[model samples]
Target: MRTLAGYTNIMSAKPGDTVEFKVSSHGPSATFSARLVRLITTEEHPRTAGLIERDVDAAFNGEYPARRQPIHTGSYGYVEHATAFSGLEDFTFQTWLWPTLLGSRRQTIAGTWDESRSLGFALEIDEAGRLTFLMGDGQGTVSTANLPTPLVERQWVFVAASYSAKDRTVVLHQSPRCDIGDLGSAETRKFDIAAVQGKSGQRHFFIAAHKASASDGLLLAGGHYNGKIDSPKLHAGALSIEEMASLASGAAVERLNECVSAAWDFSIDQGSDVFKDVSGNGLDGRLVNMPARAMKGYNWTGQFHDWRTAPHEYGAIHFHDDDLYDAGWSTDFAFTIPSGLESGVYAARLDAQDASPAYVIFFVRPPKGQATSDVVYLASTATYMAYANQTLIARDPLDEMSMGSLLVFGEDDVFLDENPEYGKSLYDLHTDGSGVCYSSRLRPILNMSPNAKYWSFGDGYLTGWLDALGIKADVITDEDLHNEGESILAPYRVVLTGCHPEYVSLAMWDALKTHLGRGGRLMYLGGNGFYWRTAFHPTLPGLIEVRRAEDGSRAWSAEAGEYFMSTTGEYGGMWRRQDRTPNQLVGIGFCAQGFMTGSYYQWSSGSSDPRVDFVFKGVNKGSKFGDYGLSGNGAAGQELDRYDPGLGSPRHAVVIATSIGHTDNMVLAKEEFGAMHWMIGGTENKNVRSDIVFFETSGGGAVFSVGSISWPMSLPIDNYQNDVSHVTLNVLERFRDPKPFSLPQ
Candidate 1:
């Protein structure tokens, strides 16, 4: 490869073109990974000019002054410099550097030390023009020791720690080499110096008077540095060749900088855009070669826009393109932002050129509590999707199978399968029948307005959810889902899952998980929503493990006969099931033997909790959240709703309101008895909301199960209702507006 900045030339090459790079070491010690190369440009950041700071920039040594110096602004700074650790190996020091707006002494972020567990250095300007690190007086040992060193001034550093458990040692090496042995003899002390932190409960982890905490990892301050760290680093243990090489070559340092490369083949759109590394650091890059990121190894959507908006007041529609998801953007191929930019919220345009409401942020402000965003984070991983598939596909005919409105389940089309009874509901968007019988039946209803416009692009994704929620998150395709959470999901209050949102990926889970852990609320309206785990290879951004089932169960396997459970992490392990339990992390429980064609009972207070007792809400005209248990809807509703209804052949499910006689299957193992199934993670299940009178548990999640297959349909749409109280309104009231936000005399 060329220098870090040269990857663009490689990316500009057409298919079958060559991409090359070099990662050689010239220092005494060296460490590097093939993954460290990145090509930076202004393409990802349509609003910014150049890089502010790069990763792996901070460096320290006894070279300048032992004391810390503030490196601030314009993309390069040094920070948190101190006498970190020193021992028989070498004394070590570390700091971070960043670029700023104009001229400023504050870094976008700074490092924090466990002063209690670290050796503090003295920062003093000697008579010469050099910065130095000095301890107490001590006529001490001979020779020298090793220390920390930056590749150069203003470079960012991931982390640095040093220790000198041994007393007699001294030596020094400079940048590119990062070593230090001795300065001169030591003298006596005015006071005793502190030691560096060690692992576990060893004497090494002891705290010093320097003021420190063991876990002070992130410090979002501001500033940049004009100097470099001198003679740093001392390890608690002996240095092996690999370890020495690691420090020398700055292996971790490269990661600290965010490596990118034009080295991989690019066929499809990997949702390329600008992103932030850990410390307000940004990576600005994209997959210029269009065909490389394809799903089926073909670049068909090389032109369409996924969530792009109109001009003018349509700011929500800017900067996004219709990302070419191979057939569908599986979680396997991810769109990545390069490394070495400044910290801040950078926009990521995966589907369009204009900055549509869809984007990603790296340097976002800390959310006060649960960060709420109107954007939806759909799952991409085959594994998670498979999990959801198993849960949604196995339902009783007459059983109520509703998608969690607030759960953010799979897409609107998943529930439209061509199962035995209603398999015709499923549509093939790529083909001529995506709207299938459902769309054909509703076409007249939709066209009733005379000017009802047909959806020019894909399915009814936009109007289906956004119009219902009344919120403004654009329905993103598989293209822009990866980097969206950093900027997109941080603003909305709720994310809704569809009838059978079974296809979920890993990063999508992480983003959503982090979003919820931060206190966001979720409404799992459908069973087996986001359930699988999948990843994108560092090089391959398009080719995913496309799946099909022999028995039509919708369950995916590696090759032929092999199931997802049988696949390993790298070897294609699809979905990892938590287990089966009655009490879910959310208030939803699942079983398979009920919905096929049976009587779903009148939703009564199955337990003692008054909040969950459907009757407590008072039986109105039998809405979705009603106690009277309405069975169906209009002919249009029935024709539209009577499709596969998804949830086919679920091996394991948390059956909420199903017949007791059906045998439930989760992990594909044959079972002779009725097993209580469950899932893990999140504390939303059985949550006690402020509006709800008491703590309640449905199955798992901040959830409420209608215990029927068609509750979503029965739930009133807009102001139209099947009864007096709107179905979702009744449910929403119990959770939030119990007393009603509007009260009049």
Candidate 2:
């Protein structure tokens, strides 16, 4: 346990809406103090500067005690009924499965057993990858039988277990799917035991897991199944081998002669949590933890791409042992944002006597239908959620050189590496070693704290620069823009975005584009903005889905034919690949990235153009624009963007300044090349540089892009007197004017 950590329910709340904080500590009992403080970016480097917090006399401020809480990972479905499987003496259980993890672990595909009491039956994959069937008698005894052949990983196979009470015998069978022949041999095993009566208790039917006992009479689900499971069926009587073969070979349930007690058809209810039983028994089950639905099932022949258009081709539900849609933890504390509270970044600071301090960050929006200032700052909550609780320290080379020499590793980084159960970012892999495609904000996001430096350079630096300049600005989150769309931006004259606003949902993207089209001014303060095409569930809040496909900087690529999101049924990948490139909206697109260090930007020839004289009114033409800052000690570094007309940069867009002197480590983005080679490095490629761009939309709308994630970090240097700050302030002040921008004729 790394100390105290927590996360909030929502990123931004309007006045009168309640916000909840869920905090978890390490010790048995911990004393902690909580207070509301507004966060401003001072410096993100842990060793050099700390987050500047302003005490806000809000409702929460006191010392309290809290108990340690546990987090459970994995997803499964279960059917709970008083008489689900009431009086069945001889029965058979069968399912089509594609196992991802088959090495040495007991995984239950479908079971009606309670391990603590040793009763009921379970058809499971044993530790040695062989099919095992266990039938427990009313008394504390169990009859077990195992198939002779072991199963292979990631291969479709049919498995079944049947018991005949009259004969006192159990048969287990396993065979590979006909489509992918030669995967495994068809085998069966029989076992004889003393005659025992089938007993019924409080045990419920579970798919992908079984009930296991824990300390203090606590019952938890264990033996979680990994990979895909489709059309699990339970018959009232032992079915013959010929009948089982017909069912496995795509026989319709209505045509089958066997009496199915409960048959779950994952193909139905593609949009809901309910899995219907087509056998007409009405023994429907509810999915737990929200497993991936509308996936490609075993019989899928790749005839159609969209699941909605071809439902049968996508019947399987991919269930992972570590798939988490929510933490479901009880709120430790709750407070309503006061009606008069200022709109800014605020957090509930938690300090403990025996543990490290933790902060649950939240943003308070201005009063509904009102704007405190003409300038509104858009917090990249989507990006924050995408990188929530990122375990980069454990996955990446985080030494001083890899993370830049100035990068500082703090205790929070070590804590996340040690305690991975808190959850992981979409960039991480699950316990089964499969790529994590989904991430939710319902759990405690340890990396989104003020004391954390993971993504602080983006949001923290922007807020701190605003505070130091005494700029009065209202704050809104990415979720706010996603939910409300353009109406949210209609109240303000100038809208500003934070650093690294990369992960963008379709709704958010449409809203921003609509705002720009309607003559709304936008100042994109970071690079790599609007990169990935993301999707948010219509009903599931705090959950965003991403499918890494077609190319961009990514940890893993989505499997073939699986690039579409299961939530919205939309194709997932980079926006550029979808024909909505970032350059179209922000005047620049992601170009390159170098983690080692930063460089300075020089004024381009277009900076002296009389048409854009107002943008650089106070800055010197010959002087280097950005040469000093907290992050990397310079303005342009980390991820960078460049203007390219072929990729959708407007014909009238101008490159006002460009970063120079980037090291060879800064390589061109993968999307820019046809092949990977040494020519992609900044030392050889001219396109591997951040281009500060400016463009005007129809009806007086204008966009100013910094094209670098480190640009805002250079604002606080020299008491905010640097040319970077001067140029940014000039744009903001001019953008706030009610007069419509007039393009030179």
Query: How high is the CA lDDT of each candidate model?
Result: 0.24, 0.80
Whole-structure CA lDDT of model 2: 0.80
Query: Would you list the clashing residue pairs of candidate 2?
Result: 41-464, 74-321
> Model 1: residues >4 Å from true position, as ranges?
1-488, 531-552, 555-590, 593-601, 606-608, 611-701, 705-709, 716-719, 723-725, 733-745
Each model's total of backbone clashes: 229, 2
Candidate 2, 1-745: lDDT as tens digits: 3578777787789999999988778755557789988877634454334567888886668877776777777788888778766476778888889988986589988878778777777888888888888767757677777876778888888888777778877777777875545545676666775636456674478899887754665447788999899888888776556655555556754533457788889988765667988888888987767777878888788877777888887889888887787776778788898888889888898887666667788889987678999899998888888888777656656434456555455676677666667777888777666677778888888777765564543577777777777889999988888889999898888999988899998889888888878888999998888998887777888888888877888877777667788788888899999999999999899999887778898889998777678887778777576877766777898889999999999878888999998888788888889866779877899999999988888778899999999888777777678898899999998889888875546
Q: Give RMSD to native, each candidate.
A: 25.7, 2.5
lDDT of 1: 0.24
lDDT of 1 by residue, 503-598 (tens): 444555555556545444344443333333334333334222222322222322222221221111222232324231212222332322112221
Q: Which 10 consecutive residues of model 2 have the lowest summed lDDT?
A: 42-51
lDDT of 2 at 610: 73
User: Roughly what TM-score does model 1 have, to 2 decimal places?
Assistant: 0.31
